[model samples]
Target: MDHRFVGIPELTAVPRVAVVVDVMRAFTVAAWAFSRGAERIVLAPTVEEALALKEGRPGWLALKDGAPAAGFDAVNSPGLIRSRDFAGRTLVQKTTAGTVGALAVADAPLVLCASFVVAGPTARYLRAGAAGPVTFVVTGEDGRADEDLACAQYIGAHVSGGRVDPAPYVHRARNSRAAADLGAGRRAGCHPDDVELCLEVDRFPFAMVARREDSLTVLRPVTAPVNPAR
Candidate 1:
């Protein structure tokens, strides 16, 4: 199994197994929502599409980042997501990087939505015998999203049969310019606490797998043993 890392611009080269990562609160919020019992999440590339998906759907909730949209249930903040009850409901999520990246590679045979929150479990799921040439899609713009790149490498190291400490990656992400901007209130509609939440390594014990469902890229959590017998 070979692992390749690529940024959003290089998404066209995505392989059979694509791990789309968004660490600065996109996939991290997704992990929290799943942990809170969300049935499934429908990823939309645009905010308009997310709201449209939630429109007239009784059990659907819409969420996005940067300025509240008309029909969104909440911003893409993990703090707000943690406080809400999403049990058995479907979430329609749109983000600048995460959702767009996932949708771009939705045609891949196996697409996993990734963040530090689900990093360990995601790696284990791949190591458990999923077909590869795995590609880690860094949703953060090419060369600028340090947090997403770190997460991709973190998961890559694990999938490569190496015992890599997650502390450095977490530290790198915490100090990333994106995190700095959010913490300093430079980025609106994003919470400062979200940076810490997004950097919580192995916070969830499941990997989020995305599947193409009609026009939506639906993600569902798949749990795997933390330390499977080798």
Candidate 2:
């Protein structure tokens, strides 16, 4: 399969397997939520929908909207997700980039949601599928640069069967105007720690896979249920 990294602007050219990356918060938070026992995640295109879902799901929790540059769930920090109890719950998430990007690319045949946390499993899932071009889309702050681009580089390296090198983007990512937006969340208030968490590749063993529905797409973790016997 042909795979390459492209910015959101060039997304139309390669629309088959569009892997949306929002490592710093959106996608990273999604991964963390799932890992914490969130039964399912509904990717809401708008904060309204996210809040609605939270209200509808009874036990469902949400990550609300942040500032102009920042995104939903400034409270949905990695630390919050990592430390909180979601033993039998689910999350309805919305964001400026990650969820929006996934919503925008809902028309694509195979749209995969990814981040550094699930990068390895995401790669394995792609490699195990049919041979087709995969486009790595970075959903940055205001859908621009740094975190998303860095994530794109990370995923791009794996997709191309090369070693991951995020240094180039990391240095540049630190200087991005959107960097602060990404750091607005709780875990991110301490930027360095958040960055380190965001850069930890292959931390998860499953990938969040999405398929188009009537007008929306459904995203859920791709993993075989644990066998109670094994």
Candidate 3:
């Protein structure tokens, strides 16, 4: 099986296993949310769909801007999840890069969202009998952000029977434009604590595996991580 790290721009045919990396905040928040007891996360491709899902649902939904909506429990903030309890709750998330990329490659047989938070588990999952080619999709802020690319490589190395020290890669992401976006103070959603939380590699031992549910993808944390693929 071929394991490759690639930017979204160069995508051609989808792989048998496609891992979407959005370390900036989307999947990072997802890892923390699952750890915080979130039952399941519904991936919404558009802001309108996310809000619509939350109309009569039990869980909350965040806007594409990652802001706290009126009826939502909290925004897509890893730091926020650190302080709240979303136990048994469901969350509808619509992000610019992460969700967009995940939906873009919905044709792939097995799709999972990963970030530094669940990087280790993701590697383990892919390494465990996931046949055919594996494509690591880096969901950059717009094009190719350094953080997501580094994360894609970090996971790719492990799936390819190699190891990578995350320290240097994390350091590089800390100085990337995506990291800078969090520290900019221009966006209300980005916080210092959130930035720190997003960079904590291997913080969670599970991966949010996405299944093709009807027209959209629904994500749930597979504790075994590898079992989801097998």
lDDT of 1 by residue, 1-230 (tens): 68878888876654789999999878999999999989999998777777778996887999988777677887888866787888999999988889888888888899999999999998898888578589888888673699999999999998887478999988899889889888887876776588888888888889999998886789999987767643
CA lDDT of every candidate: 0.86, 0.67, 0.78
Among residues 3 or more apart in sequence or in different chains, the pairs in candidate 3 whose N, CA or C atoms overlap within 3 Å are none
Query: Candidates 2 and 3: which is better by TM-score?
Result: 3
lDDT of 2 by residue, 1-230 (tens): 57666656566653877888877677877887778787667778777777766776577777733432232333545755576666667677776677877877777778888877787677667766635787777777445677677666666665556355656756665655555554654332333356566666778888898776554466778962222111
Model with the higher lDDT, candidate 1 or 3: 1
Candidate 1 C-alpha error for residue 222, in Å: 0.7
- Looking at model 2, report the run of 10 residues with the lowest lDDT sum: 65-74
Tens digit per residue, CA lDDT, model 3, 101-175? 888788888888999989888888777746778888888854478999888888887666546788888998899
Q: In model 3, where do residues sit more than 4 Å from their true spots?
A: 58-64, 225-230
TM-score to native of every candidate shown:
0.95, 0.78, 0.90
Query: Which segments of candidate 2 are over 4 A away from where they belong?
Result: 7-14, 65-74, 141-144, 162-192, 213-216, 224-230
Candidate whose lDDT is highest: 1
Model 2 residue-pair collision total: 1
Give candidate 3's error at residue 170 in angstroms.
0.8
| Count of backbone clashes, every candidate in sequence | 0, 1, 0
